[model samples]
Target chain A: MARSDDEYDYLFKVVLIGDAGVGKSNLLSRFTRNEFSLESKSTIGVEFATRSIQCEGKIIKAQIWDTAGQERYRAITSAYYRGAVGALLVYDITKKDSFDNVQRWLKELKDHADANIVIMLVGNKSDLQHLKAVTTDDASAFAESNGLSFIETSALDNSNVEEAFRSILSEIYRLGSKKALEKGSTSNFAPNATQTIVINPPADEGKTEKAKCC
Target chain B: MTDDKTLFGVSDGLLPGRVVRLGKPVDWASILKASQDRERREKEKRDSSSSISDLKSSQTSIPSIKPKSKKANTVIEESSSPTDGETETGKQRTAARENSSSSPSATSSEKLKQLLAEPTLNTEAVRKLAWAGLESEMRSPVWKVLLGYVPTNLARRNDTLRRKRREYQEAVNQHYDPYLDTKEQSVVTNSSTYNRIGNEEDVTFRQISVDIPRTCPGQALFHIPEVQQALKRILYVWATRHPASGYVQGMNDLVTPFLFVFLSEYASVKDDLSLLKATDLSVFDNADEALSNAEADSYWCLTALLNDIQDYYTFSQPGIQRRVHFLRELVARVDGNLCTHLEDEGLDFLQFAFRWMNCLLMRELPFHLIVRVWDTYLAETDGFATFHVYVCAALLVTFSEELQDMDFQDLVMFLQNLPTESWTNREIDVILSQAYMWRTIFGAAPSHLQQAFQASY
Candidate 1:
């Protein structure tokens, strides 16, 4: 379920989607809770956890959704795309197949997801630099062409894990706030859409949503 | 069937693991009865799905939006079971089964008929054979797997034990040898050590492998020939329905009992083969074979399931750790209060919960007694959550009376060995029931599994 935690300024539904063994769940575990399980079970369905962080003076509650990667499970999982604000399209840098499968995953998102879902290309397991298949330049360039934010991370070593999530959240938040300012008292918020929009915030733009009711 | 070398004289190449002493033998008729009952139940379940579909159609007019994006929502990590809505992708694929043109989902009787095909002592049937190590072929298949895993070296090293095992084997040989004048047993030996043994007794020593199963009961159909036959057919139907996970190594073990009970419909055989084939079989994925997967994929998931809780997987399945970690901490918490309590009591969580962790109280309980456990478990998915807590509370309460007098070690041993008794004893049931009611009232445990069903998509 999408959250609207009235007390918080922002509610972000962030999804971790990637290849079967690219460590999407691990990244979520590391960023949201700073914990990891070496022998985690193959996720059967969907799992969720929430953590709120103070970003730019607003308590941004990141409602993270972790999903199973098996091809068949997708039938049951596709329904979770409703109202999601951010999608983490992850891949294992060490394995090329996972990197190659990214496009299929993207197509999956495009087919059934909200049109304006903000996606980030995350090349995870960066610690295996020697076995790296997908390079930062290649991924970032792909991200540029596809309009996704790209970053490399190693959940085990905790390298840039937080930054990747933070970058995506900031991008989503900026988009959300700028969206509020542009709509100018209209009921439209871009969180439900699938396109990327420029968020040029006027100093106090986001405060309007919370203050308007008051 | 091969009469000499293990079956038509064909050697299994690998001497299959020793059998577990679980008792009795697979009663082909009883199993057939259970199979029939299962077919009826499945038919009823299939019948139920229509109303569910009617309900679902009204509620969800918009086909689920399956974006090509990676993650959709927070799903329970352990979702082999199909949802009530029956739209799980795995199910859809299996329902589109090519092999079973009639579709097991469509007919219950046909599924059972195929399941009851006379057992051929092939590699698959050889798996069902007994070892003197375990009492009989009647033991759960998983137990046979465990007995087989007992470190082969240990069996070879212990001379006294080897002698006892050999004597027991000789006894069984004598009885089956046909020239025997009386019941053959170890007692006729020159020494008295063999006299302590009985026909029903099984040897006790270190066990090698013990992966615990999900706390859901093994298959629990009832006892009637037609019903049993129907269920056997359904088992095969289910197997064909999920061809990828078809006939997995350990599945027959977990499924046998359910197949057995469902077979006991005690009603007229429906002969509804087409309807039986309609079952959706995609949702299940076994951790062992993860069946039909490329070795790479199977190893990948199996490693995930078995690797952590590391040693637990070495002995049992990984799910054991979720509660064992909690219980271990709980033991530490209580014992920390008084080292003397731990020292005086002489308790250790692993030894106590080792087998419990290995088989989830299933192995420890007799087959017949498990029906009640299944009844409760099927009613709720978190049955284990409730069961584990009640076990903790009961262990505490049972010993709470003599809390100070008992040494921690002795207490731990008692707790560890408690489930291995001849019968479950009333306390375990009382405690399990209490936990179930308490949790039902208190609210289900706050875990991903609880909120999973209602999650979006």
Candidate 2:
């Protein structure tokens, strides 16, 4: 009773986290549903939505979880960290405190999430240039030092929102393909192996495997 | 009459005389406390000139049956009599009622007591008082009674409190024994219980561990070690007992208002949190007892509230999904232009409204407004679940003009940071009134939402 559109070659669980009021939910909404609100309430625990994206002839389903940014919510939100192959550590560019807390968030990811979790340091609310507190260069430098990919996005204007998702998913895919390659040629074993990789994504797989069904 | 500007004005001072300055981050709890003191003093001054017999006659003749009910609690009288001067809790009850009869501001409190004291307890009357906003001192008792946490019978209420507090302590002690054992042994002796492996306990326990410190981390009272542990125990027990919904993230935020309000019943922390030294709390002779009572009250009220909207926390959150869908449709019918505007910008109700529905808009509104709103919510039959849709719609409609002008990025920014801290009881009244208007137009939740709600549960 599931829709055919739900079928996918790979499923990657991604999580969005940062300080409270940094627009994590809005970013998830813009990416998954292409919608924004002027009166969005703060996230409570964890909410997830799935969107399947086309990646080099393969349908990669992104099961993105948007989490509460408050400190108390970390308890409930941390439970969602397991099995996440990708994380978007979003911070409001206007709030220096949010950007400063990025390191703390990184430590959280290291402690609870997958060790090789594809983390993208997202400076959200990029449209609020007039109120920018964390400069692009500073966040970029921090991301480089921490070995995280960096991008600026405005979930409001839909700026870089798609690219943010595409970039992370593609990065996750790239790493996954590489791992598959190193495992040697095993076409029969690829799909099952890749399916498990959705949670703990493998490091190599250049060839994109297309499922025979659907 | 206090000028609206002075009472709820946008003052530039660090501390205003009697009103909460709009747009400034004032110590909200202090303002509530200050207002209470002012009302009491005013009532005392007015009552001092009246003959003692006249005061007694007014107390007996008033609609409230509180005096008769109080006589049932001999235990309460014995415990409270010694501390009468310091607490004035008993005298305050009489003053609270008499003040209500004399002043327009205490009208809700007077009506609330009358409704709560009836043989069966008039739920309809309580709901109306909730809309009107409860008196500061009366909210705790009113909420407990409304939520069915305490017995309706006056004689049974004290005994019920005593029993429930004991039950809560037992639950906490049992769950915490393993952790305490490991602490004393300095070894992983209780691994079976302590190091849970992928069971329901481990999952929810880990959640409570991380969440307890974060719940209202901004507040001084919540920062205390004792408060944190109590919150942890309360949430953990709630999650364990309710296995179906275990511990969810936002539930932490929901427990705080109850804890804050209930704690204020015993302690006299200063309004200015910065001034509260750690040593000040030691002054309370029975802080542990007071805290346990607060914990029990918070747990029960939270359970009552969650029960009304349990579907929202269930797996896949079908309740929220349905509510979001309904909100979107409701907006379309109520404000087609604004709804279409958001649609053109590719905005949906779920992006913002989901939190509104999940937490009953607690995240959007400050504690002051939230407490006032909750008074009415506890009164209404379906205030938290169904009626909230209208409130959300009314809230959104207030910003239609700005929303109509904003693009996607602007919409997202504006929504995530709405300027609601400045909102007073007046604004909330307007929102509630407007919500009632929408209810009149649309009736109860439309057919689709009903089906979605039914299907989820």
Candidate 3:
């Protein structure tokens, strides 16, 4: 489906890394296909899904790569870090072990991903409030200290799933725009500037163009 | 009860160890007549109960009398006649009970060993009866032969292992030579050149590297460098060879059972797998020799398995989608009411069955039982790819009552994490038997399903 509707201004590779059973695959499915699985098995190597979004008037096609969360999976997942412009560093809110491994995941990103890759600290499974082990305040503070954006999502309940992707993509787009302005035409912004689709609507059709973004 | 106790006491000791028959010798005609009468009575009772309960939960009772309603309807029609099919299931259960009473390991090993020795044995027949489940000790060799890791010819088996091990080492040696370098400049230079070939190899190598350590992190045997590198080499080589599919995430999981089973063969202590953890060099005493052989055996077996299901891992993953589609249709045909309930509740087959089909139900069952399931799959005609659809249908049918009762979220969650860790060989047998029944009924690609498949495409 993503392949069929491929008219996009920008293609950003966003990697999802977290602990096993942290629901990275479900999150990706919920966002891309509008589907989620409660019986989500541990990711094997790497699985990718593409979804296009309108961010800052540019068609941004987000190619999200979900990686296995186990320590050894880093071997293969680290390779996926190449060409990634964004990283969704996910941890289960109900799982303290998953939350504790966020720092290690951050280290993995730093080691393998691009230096300027936008990182998001996502405390997923927010719907499981009763079983919540990692508090929102604590996760937000941790994200703040680590210089990363933060969000809480419930893929099962379809809560914050869309906003999480939008936030990350918008952030990546803003950074790309800023970098482009500084360097003028020769901006070394991403893997490709040609891939980014910037639609310039006529001034009179502004309202319609804005409505078309979602 | 006192007479039974006296009879038990007369048989050597109070507990009959391995050699004892509980039934007395009866005339052949009487034995046949007795089973027939019991089967007839059982069928009548089952039919009467089903007719009474059919109105309330038509789908729920279908599995109980599934054999009778094989050709009934596309919507799980009620049985037309109670005596439509033979009560073979009752007989099979009795046979299975008898088999369990005997020495499981000794009898299974003997049957399998004999079958292996026969040059012209019907493997399909062997796989259908008793062989679906095997003894622990018999698995290593049986799986190796089943997966085509070893040649069926006895004379060629040793030579095959020798050549494959040598080839595996050569590949590992050549590929990992850069990692062995001490100097920084050479490593960088080599990496850049490696990148020049295409980033595919580098990505493959890195993916394998990360996944190997993570494959089975809790298991100490996997932590050892020897085991880790072996997994790495096998995965990397497979990815390199199959550029179209490359390395998907789940392929790593498929490789584990083979490696564990192969390594088990070389481990000195047969019963206790934990003893292998005591050694640092390798799990087995022969160290590198056994490790390399295991690596080679695992690599080939994994390759064979991927060859059968490679479409699932390809970039587009149409294989999984097709299988999932087939499962939906299969479920509709086999348990129409449950299928209708799922449709009403907005439950999709891909939500849970994708993993079921992709992993060949490996994720659902534990390691010991996974092999047993595979034993049946490997024996069937395109069992992994074709027969698996029925297995998925059978699994869904098992949860029909609960699925109908639950709402969307609960159903999705429940399907995602069916508590299967405690599932033993018996549970697998039930699922497999039900799957086999479905296969006989709807194995042929029916016209309705073909249209559904085409419409989706």
Per-candidate chain B TM: 0.33, 0.70, 0.70
TM-score quality measure for candidate 2 = 0.57
The 0-to-1 C-alpha lDDT of every candidate, in the order given, reads: 0.42, 0.65, 0.63
DockQ of each: 0.01, 0.06, 0.05
lDDT of 3 by residue, B307-426 (tens): 666667664466786888888887887789998887666455665676777677766666666766777676554667777887778877888887888754356557766778788766
DockQ, structure candidate 1: 0.01
In model 1, how large is the Cα lDDT of residue B155?
Answer: 19
Instruction: Show model 2 residue runs off by greater than 4 Å.
Output: A1-214, B1-102, B110-120, B178-199, B269-285, B444-457
- lDDT tens readout by residue for model 1, A51-127: 66767776666667676564544543454554566889988886665677789999988875557788999999888
How do the predictions measure up, each by TM-score?
A: 0.37, 0.57, 0.56
